[model samples]
Target: MAKTIFITGASRGFGRIWAEAFLERGDQVVVTSRKGSGLSELVEKYGSAVLPLELDITNRAACFSALEKAKSHFGRVDVVINNAAMGVVGMVEELGEQESRDIIEANLFGTLWITQAALPILRAQGSGHILQLSSALGVYTFPSVGIYSASKFAVEGFSEALSLETKDMGIHVTIVEPNGFSTDFTASTIQSKPLPAYDQVRTALYSNPAMTESDTYGDPKATAAAILKLVDATNPPLRLFLGKKALPLAKAVYQQRLASWEEWNTVAIEAHGL
Candidate 1:
């Protein structure tokens, strides 16, 4: 059965990859880009199979309006991919106040609005899947990318709750956590001014095997088939890690976290007043 998938940020990166995959498989797609640039090829090639929309996901009203227009054009929307978000590269103190806030605004609040916009439509149909593009940093953290990680962390939190809330409505929510990908993700991020004090910290990150290794990044094109299988599953996972890095990183992070929590159990129990 051909499905209609609505995707934000479909002009590039994983969004474009998945959008093309769906179109090639005879599925209808409603693709969005901020300036509406880079979408002409999709229209020219895919014809009516792709509906390109000029959208800013941060605008709540615009998000709702876009979903309505998609439903009107397609007659039904089966999948919604919230792949639009901003990335900021900075150490904790290096980030500007407005820069930190804007990253959160676009990554966390923007995703929230789009998910909110899709809920009503999906609920009405009683069958829909939502894919949120979170990050491996959402599950774990590093020094230089705190603000961006914080935004993704917030997204992971709310998206988990959203999955539970929508399960009864036959709506499936999948939070996609991708590690480093060779998709201009690192190159295209908004970088903050360098603080001389953190030079050593930056150098250490650059020198780390995990950060610099060739295998750390995965090909974005290879992900389309995995996502296609995911949405086709009868029971998909609430959390889907895109590359090999996320699971191993998550395991190490949680092990250390659990060890610390156990070590502090006495204090935690005392503070609980139980």
Candidate 2:
């Protein structure tokens, strides 16, 4: 049984890796790139099994049209990977209007548009899975990555709600949270103009062991194998963490969160007046 996977941002990094994995296994894929860099190679290698589209997912109409074309070309999309997103490297106060807007537009809204476009097709078919590319930053945060993490946090919020909303429709939503990977993701992140006032703050964050990976960055190729198992599973999780660091980071973050919430529960309970 071959699956039809429609993935955005297939020009590089995790997208390219995953797309190749699918093609190697005889799965047909509809892969999109913003500037149209990665698609040609996929088509050259896989022939008609790869449908390449030039897409800027930030454009809402284009997203809908792309999805429609994929459905028309492939007849059905078994998996929709909303993996096209951008990151802005900035402290919250260091961010400018354009920097904040670009990150939010590409990461949050682009994801929303694609998810919206895919829903009807999945609904009609009564089966589908959506993989939302989020980050460990979505679960926690770092100072310099406030804007980037905010975008991921927003992604996590809606995706969790979406998982619940679509479960009965046979449409599964999974948020893919990857810790720091040895991909160009970090290098490619758009940098906001520096604020000298926050130099020490930024320095401290960058100096932390966790910031630069207490362990080495995870291998990007490993992710492709994980998702192969993921999409093939009958019961998949709503949240899946990639890389070795995510689980430990999540546990530490959640434990601290639980402790704080428990400590503050008295005020919360009193406010409810029950």
Of the candidates shown, which would achieve the greatest lDDT relative to the real structure?
1
Clashing pairs in 1: none
- After superposition on all C-alphas, the RMSD of every candidate to the true structure, in Å, is 0.9, 1.3
| Span of 10 residues, lowest total lDDT, candidate 1 | 180-189
Report the lDDT tens digits of candidate 1 across residue range 1-274: 9999999989899999999999999999999988898899999999999999999988999999999999999998999999988889889989998888888878999899999999999999999999999989999999888999999999999999998888899999999999888895553478999999999999999899998888989999999999899889889999999999889889999999999999999999999985
lDDT of 2 by residue, 26-135 (tens): 99999998988858988998999999999999999999999999999999999999988887877888889987988899999999999999999999999999999999
Question: lDDT score of model 2?
Answer: 0.91
- The alpha-carbon deviation from the true structure for residue 183 of candidate 2, after best TM-score superposition, in angstroms, is 0.8
**TM of each candidate vs. truth:** 0.98, 0.96
Residue 18 alpha-carbon offset, candidate 2, angstroms: 0.2
**TM-score attained by model 2:** 0.96
